[model samples]
Target: MQNKIESLYKETLKIRLFEENLIKLFSDGKITGTTHTCIGQESNAVGIASLLKKDDCILSNHRCHGHFLAHTNQYVGLLKEILGEEDGVCSGIGGSQHLFYQKIFYSNGILGGNMPMATGLSFANKMKKNNKLVCLFIGDGSFGEGNIYESLNFISVFKLPILIVVEDNGIAQTTETKNTIANKIEKITASFKIETSILNYPDAYDIYTKSKKIINKARKGYAQIIVIKSARIGPHSKGDDTRSIKQLNLIKKKDPLIKIKKKIKSKEKIKKINLDVINEINKIFNFKSQSYSNRKVSLQNKKNLILIDNPLKTFDGKRFGELINHFFHIIAKKNKKILFFGEDIVDPYGGAFKITKNLKNLYKNQVFSTPISESTIVGMSSGLAIEGYRPIVEIMFGDFLSLAFDQILNNLSKFYYMYNQSITLPLIIRTPMGGGRGYGPTHSQSLEKFFYGMHGINIYSLNPFFPLEKIYEEAFQNINPNLIIENKIQYNFILDDLNNSKYKSLNTKNDIKNFITNMSLSNYEDDCRTIICHGGASSAVINFAYDDFIETENSSRIIILSKLNTLNIEEIKKNISDKGPIIITEESYKSFGLGSEIITTLIEDEKFKGRNYMRISSKEGVIPSSKSKEEDFLLSAKTINKKVYNND
Candidate 1:
C-alpha cells in the first residue's frame, strides 16, 4: 500500500509539474496552441489508467494532458507534442488537444465526440472477443451533448465492454456545470440502466480501487460508468481562468498530489523523484534534434493499375440496384470481416433505397440496422476499422453526410497521417448521391464535391458501364477508407454491352469517330479534344447529345471517369491530344466543385497552358422538386449540345 501510494504520488507529481512547466512556457509564448491543464483532477486519470491493461483502449477529451501522461508515460513525446515539435507524439499534427499513442490511446478536441468512438472501440473488442475494455474520459460539459446519450444507449443495447469516465469538474469551460446541466450524472446514466459509481475528490489509491472493480465488470461484456467529482485548479485553458482566488485556494487544498505526498511523508525521496523528472523533461527539450518535415503518406507502396479482368460472376440482365445487392452478397460471403452498418438496412426494409436487401438474413451477426444517428454510424465505423474490421457503412443519402463531416474530415481522414502512418483505417462509407429522383433539395444532392480534396480517402462513383462486382472487390481490398457515391438514377438502369462500349457517334466524319478508330487500330491522334464526365451526368450527356455533338465537333472525343480523387492525371493526359481543348462536365454546382478542380489541375500543367478549357456544370441554386425545374438546374444534353455547338 505504501509503495502504491508513492507510485501514485510520483505519477501525479509528474503530470502536475509537466503541466505547470507548460503553463509557464505558454505564458512566455513558447507553446503555440491553447493548453488544457488537469492539475487538480490528476487523480481521475492516473487512478483509472492504473487499472487499464496495456492493450485496453482509452479515448480522451480536450483536457487530455493527464490522460496522455498516465496512459503512455512517454514524457519526452508528450512534452514535444505540447511544444508542437515534429518528433512529438502524433508527429506534431495533433497538438495538446489531439494526441494519439499507438492503438490504445486517442484524444480529440471536440466535446462528446470521443464517446461514440469509445463505444465503437468497445464494440470492436466485443466482436474480436479480445477481453479488453475501452475507457472514455469525457468532461462534465459532455453531459449536455446528444452524442453522449446516443453512445450510452448504443453501448447498453449492444452490451459492449466500455467504461465511461465522467470527469465532473463542476465547470464546463466558462460555464459552471450546475448552470448548464439539469440532472445529476449518476441519475442520468442510471436511466439507461448502466451500472454507475461515483467518487468525490478521491486520492489516487481511492480512484484505483474503485475503477478496477468497474473495469473488471466491463471486461466481462458489461457497460459501466464512473463519475469522478474532480476540480479544475487552473483556467479551463490558457488565459481563461474565471475562478476567484477563494475557489482556487479551495481546489488547491484538495489537490491529490498534496494528499498523497502527506501520506508518503518522505521529503528526501519525493525531492529526489521530482529532481529526476525535471531533469528528464529538461533534457528532452534541450536535445538538439533535426527539425520536422511534412511527409506524404501513401496507402499503396507501388503504383499499380487496378485491373478488372477477373470480375465477379453476375447473373444476366441485372439492373444497377440488383447488381449492387449482388455485389454486397458476394463480398460479405467471401470476407467475414466485412460488417454492414446503416439505418433501416436489415431484413424487409433493406435500407432507404433497398440496396442492402437480404444482407441481414444471410449474415445476421455481421449486419446491423443502426439508429438515425449519422455521427455514431460513421464514428463507430472508424473505431471498428481501426480494430481490423472492414466496416461498410451506409448513410442513406449523400446530403446527410454533412451531419458526419467531423468524423469523416477531422477523424477518419486524419487518423493515418496523425498517427504517423502507424495505423490504417480501412473503412468504406457507401452512400447514394445525385438529384434525378425528385427527393427534394435536402434528400437529393450531388455533394461529392465537398469531399473531393480530402487526403487519405478515395471517392468512387458507380458507372452503369462498369461492373459493380469489380468495384466492390477493389473497395473491400483497399487499404484506406473509400466513399462510394452511388447515383439514385442509375439504380434501375439495365446493365448491357451498349453501356460499356467506347465513345461512338452517328456522324462518320466526327473527330470522336476518328479518335476511336485510331485507338482501335493502335494509332494516336495529337489534336483530338477530350471531354470528361462522371456519375449520372455522363449518362445524361451520352443519351441526349452524344451523336449530335460527334456530328458537329470533329476535333473532340469523350471518356467516362469513375474515380474522382487520386486522379490518374498522367493516364488522362496520355489520351488527350497535344494542346487540345479539354471540356469537363458534372451535375454538381460549379463553385468549388469537381469541374473547378479539373480546370485547376489542367491550368497547373505547364504543357497544357495553351489548351482551351471549359466546364459544363449545374448553376449554383437549389434543385426544385419539379422534374422540369430540376432538369434546368442540372447540366443536361441540351445544355451540353448548346455549349458544344454554340460555345455558350
Candidate 2:
C-alpha cells in the first residue's frame, strides 16, 4: 500500500507537471487556440485512472488534459492534436477540449453535454452484459443543465453501470458555482436515489481507495456518483480565470500533489518520475502519430443501389400510419440491434399516432418508452450509436423537437466531425408534424424549418403516393442522423390511393440515392402548370388535379421532394423549364420551408426568375383546435387554388 501511494504520487506529479508545461507552451505561443488545464485537480484524474479497466469508458469535460494524460499517457499525441498536426490522435481535428482514444476515453468540450451519452455507453455495456462501467467526469457547474438531471434519472431508473465523477472546482468559466447553482450538486444526485459519495480536498490515495469501491459497486449493476472537491490551480482557459491572487493562494495550499508528496518517503522515485514526465514534454514537439484532419461530410449517399428493392411495393388498403407501423416490424425483425425509443411507444398505447403499435410486445428488450425526457432520448441515442447500436427515437410530436434540439445540434450532428470520423451517428428521430390534429400550438406544428440549417442530419418526409424506399436501412449505413417528418392527417390516407390517371408515383432513371430522389409523380409536359409539394401534400395535389377541380391535365407533373435538403436541382430545373407556371405548396408555415427554400434557390437562375409562380402555405396565425379552422390555417389543394386564382 505504501508503494501504491508512492506510485500514485508519481502519476499525480506527472499530470501536474504536464499541465504546467502546457500552460507554459501556451504562454510561449507554441500551441494555438485555447486549453483548459487541470493543474490542481491532477489527483482526482489519477484516482479515476487507477480504477479504470481495459474495457471501461471514461468521459471528461473541457478541463480534460490531466484525465487524458493520466489515462492514456499519449502526451505526444495530445500535444500534436493541440498543434493541429496530422499525426495527432483523432487526426488532429479534436484539439485539447475534445478527444477520442482506444474507444475508451471520450472528452467533450460542452458542459454536461456528454452525460446523457455516457448513460448510453453504460446502457450498451449493460445490454451486452460486458460488466464494464463508464466513468463520466463532469463539473459542479454541469448541474445547471437540465439534461444532467434527466441523465441521472435515466441512469438510476435503468440501473446502468456508470461512475459519475463530479470534479467540483467550484467555478464555471470564472463564475463560482454558488452564484449560478442554487441547490447542492450532491442533493440533486441523491434525489435520483442512487449511491453517492462526496470528498473534499482528498489526496490521490484517498480518492483511489474510495473510487475503486465506487467503480466496483457500479460495475455490479448500480450507477453511482462521486463528488470530488478538486481545485483549479490554473486558469479556466489561458488568461481567463477571474480568481484573485489571495483566493488562488488558498486553492494552491490544498493542492493534492503537494499533500501526496509529503506522504511519500522516497525522494529518488519522485525525482525519476518528474524527470521522465519532463523529458516526454520536451520530446512532444517532435512526436508523430497519424496525419490528422477534420472529417468532411457530404449529404450524398455513396451507395446508390441500382436494383433497390422496396418491400412495401403496394399497400393493401392499410392507412399510411399502419403501413409505416408494419414496416417498423419488418425493420426490427431484420436488425436485432435496432432500438425504438419514445414516449408511449411501447405496446398497449403504442405511440401517440400508433406507428409504434405492438413494437414493445414483440421486442420487449429493444423497445423502450420512458418519461417526457426528449433531450435524454436523443442523447442516449447518440451514445448507443457510438457503442454500435442503431437507435430510432420518436419525438411524440415534431413541435417538441426543440426540447431535444441542443443535443441534436451538439452531439448527434457534430460528433461525427468532432471525433474526426472515428465514429458514425446512426440514429433516427421520427415524429409527426402539421396542424391537422387539435394538438394546439405545442403539439401540432411543421417544425422542419428549424432543422433545415443543422448540418450532419438527413430530413425525409414520407409520401404515401410513393414507395417508402429503404430509408431505415440507409439511415444506418448513411453515417449521419436522420429525421423523418410525418403528417398527422396524412397518416389516415391509404398508400398509393392517390395514384390515378392524372398523376402516379414514378421512379425516373435519374435517381442518385436509392430511388427516393426521383421517386415522385411526374407527367412530362412543358406546357401545363407544375404543382409541387412533398409527403401528404402530394396526395392533395393529385386529388385536386385528378378530379379536374381546376381542369389541369393528367401529365401536369408534380415533384414530391422526399429528401428535402439535398435537392436534385438539375432534375427540378429540367422538369420546370418553359413548362406551366410554377406553383410551390407546403403544408407548414407561410414562409421558409421546403417550398420556399426550393423556390428561393431556383429563382437565382434566369430561367426561373421571369417565370410566373405562386407560393402557397398556411396563413400566419394560431393553428386552432377546431377541424374547420385547422383546415383554414394550413395548406391544402383548395387553399392552393384559392391563393393562386383569387389574386389573379
Candidate 3:
C-alpha cells in the first residue's frame, strides 16, 4: 500500500506537469476550444480514482483531466479526444469539453449534472445485483443545482450504493464557492440524510486513503459522501487571464508537485520516479494519440433487419393469448439488442400488459426485473445507453416517467450537445399513453410533447398503427432517443387470423374500422369541404366524413403527419398553396401545442398564400377529465366534424 501511494504521488506530479504543459499549448493556440484544468487539486482525483474497481463508473465535471487520467489508462486516447482528433472517443465531435472513455465510462464537462446519472447507475447496479459502486465527482459550485439535492435525497431514501465526492476547491473559477453556496458541505449533505465524511485533500496519499474506505463501504451496499477540501492554483481554464502573469507565476511557486517533492529526500529516488513517469507518459501518449487519431465508430449496418419487426404487430388480437405469445417471440427474435426492466416484465408475467412476457425467458441476461423505483428505470436506461446498449425501458405507465424526469431531461437530454455530440444516447423509452379506460388524467394523457420541445434532444415521439413493422424498423435503426407511445386502447384491438399457431392474429389486413382513408384521391368529392385530423381522432373523422358529408370531385385532400415534429411541410405547402380552406385539428391544447406549431410553420412557409385555415384544438386550459367536457372542448370526431361543417 505504501509503494502504491508512493507511485501514485509520482503519477499525481505527472498529471500536474501534463496540465501545465497543456496550458502552455492552449496559450500558444495549439489547443482549440475552452478547457477546465485540474492543476491545484491533483490528490483528490488520484486518491479517489485509485480506490475505484475496474467495472465501476465515474462521472466527472468540466475540470476532469485529473479525474479521467486517474481512473483509466486511456491517456493518449483522452488527449486526442480533447484535441478533437478523429480517433478520439467521440471521433472529434466532443472536444476537450466532452470526453468519454467506454472502458472507464468517464464523462468530462457538463457542470455538476452527472450526479443524478451516477445515482441512477447505482440503482441499476442494485437491480442487476452486480454489486458495482458509482462515484460522482463534482465541484462545490455544482451543489447549487437542484438536481444535486434531488439526487442526494434519492440516494439516501433508496440507500443506493453510490459514493459522492465533492471536490471543495477554495474557488469555483473566479468566484469563491462561499458566495454562491449557502450551506456548509457537510451540513447540506446531512440534511438530505446522507452519510458524510470530510477530508483535507492536501496530498494524493490522503485522497487515495479516504476514497478506498468510502468506495469499499459503497460497494458493500452503503452510501457515502467524501468532501475533499483543496485549492486551485491554475485558472478556471487555460484561456483565463484573470490572474496576471505575475500572480500566476507567484501561485505556480506553490504548485502541488513542489509540495509533494519536498517530502522526498533522496535524489536517486526522485530520479527513478521521474524516469519511470516520463517513460509511462511517452508510452501512453504515443499509443493513445496515434490510435485515437485513426479511430472510427462501429455503427450498426444501415440495412440491418434487427429493427424490421414490430412488437405492436401482436396487438392485433385475433387469439389474444396466441397474439401475446407471438408478440414476445417476435421482440425476442428481432431486437436481440433490446434490454428491459420492470417488475415482472419477464416470462409468465411479461408485464401488466404482457408486453415483455417471453422476453426474459429467451434473452436471459438482457431482459431484467428491477426494483420498484421509477427513477432507476429511467436512470439505468441512461447508463446502459452510455455503455452502448440499445435499452428499451418500460415505465409501467406514462405517469411514472415523471419520477425519472431528472435522469431524462438533465442527464440524458443534455449529454449529446453539452459534449458536442460526443455520446449517442441510443435509447428507447416505451410507455402506454392515452385515456379511454378510466386510468385517469395521469396515465391517459400523451406526454410526448413535453420531451419533443426540450433542447439538445432530437427524440422521435411516435404513436404508430397498421404499419407497425415499418415504424419499429425505423425506430431501432435510428441512433437517437426514441419515445414510443403505445396507445393502451389498442392493447386488445383485434386483427384478422393468420394460420400460424404463434401468430394467428398476425394477418396483414388494413381495416377502415379504425383507420383514416386518404381523402387525397383524385376525383373525390367533398360535401363537408375540409376536415383536419390526427391519430385516433382522425380515425373517427374519416368514417364520419365518408358517411355523412357529401363527396365532390376535385375537393379537399388529407395531410398525414405521423411524426409531429417532422410535420409534413410539403403536404402543408400543397394544402395551403392553392389558397384552399383548411381545418387544423389536434388533441392537445391551443397553447404552444402541435396545432400551434403547425399554424406557425404554415404562416412562415412561403407557399401558404393567406389561406383561411380553421384551427380545431382543445381550449387553452387544463385538460378536462370528464368525457362530456372532453368531447365538448377537447378534440374528438364529433367536435372536429361539427366545427368543420359549421358554416358549410
Candidate 4:
C-alpha cells in the first residue's frame, strides 16, 4: 500500500512537470490559448480521484490538468486539445481551459458552474438506481458564488449521492483567502446539515482511505462534503504574479513531492519507480505528437438533421387549447423517452394550460407531476437528458423562469459544450410568454432575452403567427438545446394560409431558404433609416409601418432580422451607412438585452460612420400584467414609431 501510494505521488509530480513544460510552450508561442495549472495542489486531486470507480462521474474546475491526470489516462487527448489539434478532446473547438470527456464529466471554465450540474448528474444516477456517485472538485474561491450555496442546500435537502470536494488552496488568485471567504468552508456544510470531513493533504493513502468510505456511504444513500487544505505552488495561470520568484522559493520548501520521496526506503526501488513514470511520460508525449493524422472522431452525429429540415406539416384549425391538445396527442404516439413534467401537468387534468391533454392514456409512465420546485424542474430535465431521455419541461408561466435561472444557466445551457459535445442535452423548456391576461408581474413575461449571450445556449424565441408544425421539429433536434418561448397572445392564433395546408405544398427546407433569401433581398438604401426587431412585434414593423411613421419612406425599408444572434452583416451594410440612422426594437429590457447589442454593434462599425443609432426597449422594469400597463411601458409598433420619428 505504501509503494502504491508512492507511485501515485510520482504520477502527480509528472503532471506538475507537464504543466511547467506546457507553460514554456505557451511562452514560446507553440500553444495557441490559455491554461490553468495546478502545480502544488496535486495531492487533493490525485488522492480523491484515485478512489472513484471507472463509471463514476467527475466534475472539475478551470484548474483541471490535475483532474484530467487523476481521472483517466487520455493524455494524448488532453495534449492535442491544448495544442489545438483536430484530434483533441473538443476537436480543437474547446482549448486547454475546457477538457471534456464523455466517460467522465471532464472540465469547465466557469467558476462554480458545475456544482448544480453535478447535482443533476447525481439525480440521474439515483433515478436509474445505478449505485454510482458523482464527484465535483471545487476551489475555495468558487464557494463564494451564490449558486454554490443554493446547489449545496438543495443537494443536502434531497440527499443526492454527490461528493463535494472543496480544494481549499488558501487563495483566490492573488487575493488572500481571508479577503474573500468570511467563514471556514467546512463549517458551511453544517448549516446545510450535510455529512462533512476534513482530509489531510500530502497523503494519497489517507485521502484514498477516507474517500473510499465516503464514496461507499454516498453510493448507498447519502451526500458528503470533503474539505482539503492544499497549497498553490504555481501561479494562478502561466504569467500570473502568484507564481513569482518569492512565491516560487516558498513553493520549493513546501513541495509535497519531497515529503513523499523521503518516505520510500530502497534506492533501487526508487530508480524503478522513476523509470516507470518516465516511460509513461514518453508514451503520452509521443502519442500526443502523433494524434493528428486521421482524426475523424465526432461523438454526436447529426441525428435528426433531415427531420429538422422536413418538420411535421400538420396544424388543425383549432383553438390554442385544442392545438396543444392535438400536439400532446401526437407526442404520446412518438417514443417513450419523450416525457412531460411540470407542477399542474398530470394525466387526466392534462396541464395548467391544457397543453398536455391526454398523455396519460397512451403513455402513463412517461407523464409525471413534480413538486412546485421550478429549479428542480429545469435541473431534473437536465438530468433526464444526460440519462438519454428527452424531456419537455413546462414552467407554467414565463415569470417562473426566474426561479429556474440557476439550473438553466449552470446545467442546461452548458452540459453539451462542457462535456466536449459528448452529451446531447436534447431538452425543450416550454413556457407561455408575453402579457395580456392580467396575471400580474409574477406570472407573465418574455424572458428569453436573459439567456441571449450565455456561451452555450441557443435561443429559438419566436412569435409565430400561430401553431407551426415546423417549430416542433426544430424543438426536437438532438444537436441543439432549445428554449422555446411561446407567446401567450399567439397561443390560439390561427394563420389562414397555414390552415389550408398551403405550407405543406412548399418544401420545408425551401420555405426557410426562401424566407431567408427574400428577407435579404428586401429593399433598403444607405440614405434610409433601418430598424431591426424580433419576437412578438417584429411583423408589425415588416407588414405595417409604425403608426407615427405616418410619413417617412424609410419606415417601409426597415429590414427585419429573424435569426436573433447571427445578424446578417450583408443586409446591414447595404441598408445602414453614413447617410442612414438605425433603431432596434424588442420587447425586452435595455440592459443586457438584444436591442442594446444591436445598437452597440452598429455604432462601433466604422463603415456606418455618422449614423445615429437608438434602441426602443422596455423601460428598465419588470413585465407588467395589464395590456394597458405593458403598452404604456414596453416597446410596441406605436412606441417604436414614436421614438424613431421623434428622433428624426
Best by TM-score: 2
lDDT of each: 0.77, 0.78, 0.64, 0.68
Q: For model 1, how does the per-residue alpha-carbon lDDT over 1-648 read when each residue is reduced to its tens digit?
A: 878987887788878887888898899998888889998988788989999998788899999989888988776777777777777877778888888887878999888877777877888899988899898999888899888888888888888898889998889988998998999999999999999999988888889877777889989988889998887888989878888889889888877777778887678888887888787666656645534333334546522223333233554536778778877777678778789999899999999888899999999988999878888888888788778788999999999998888778877887777666666777889898888777778987889888988887888777665555556556655666788888888888776534444343222221221111112111234335566777787677665444553465444455566677767665666556564568788888777877677778777989777778878887677888898888777788778777766656
**Model 4 lDDT at residue 143:** 73
lDDT of 4 by residue, 325-443 (tens): 56666765666667777777876777767777677766777776665667766766766677666788888887788988877776677667655666677777888776656676766
Looking at model 1, which ten-residue stretch has the lowest summed lDDT?
513-522
lDDT of 3 at 320: 36
RMSD of each: 4.6, 3.3, 6.8, 6.8
As a whole number from 0 to 100, the lDDT of residue 412 in candidate 3 is 74
Q: What is the lDDT of residue 417 in candidate 2?
A: 73
Model 2 over residues 1-648: C-alpha lDDT tens digits?
Answer: 878888898788777777777788889988889899888898998888888887688899998888887788777778778888776776777899998886778898888888889988888998899888888999998889898988888888888989988998898888989999988888878889988899998888999887777788999888888999988888888998778999999999999988988877778877776788677666664455334333333434533222334556533546888888887777787677889989989889999999999998998888998768999988888888877788889999888999988888888888877776767777888888887777776777788878886788888887665566455556667677888888888889765554543434342333435223332234353335677777667666766554533465334456667666556666677655356578777777757676777778888988788777777777776778888887778777677667656742
Stretches of candidate 4 above 4 Å error? 27-29, 239-255, 282-289, 292-334, 339-383, 395-421, 438-445, 449-458, 461-469, 491-627, 631-648
Instruction: Tell how far residue 207 is off in model 2, in angstroms.
Output: 1.4
Residues 303-421 of candidate 3 have per-residue lDDT tens digits of: 23454444444454453334544654676566655677675687788887787777777788678776666665566566666545567778887767777676677667666554434
Evaluated at residue 423, the lDDT of candidate 4 is 66
Identify the superior model by lDDT, candidate 1 or candidate 3: 1
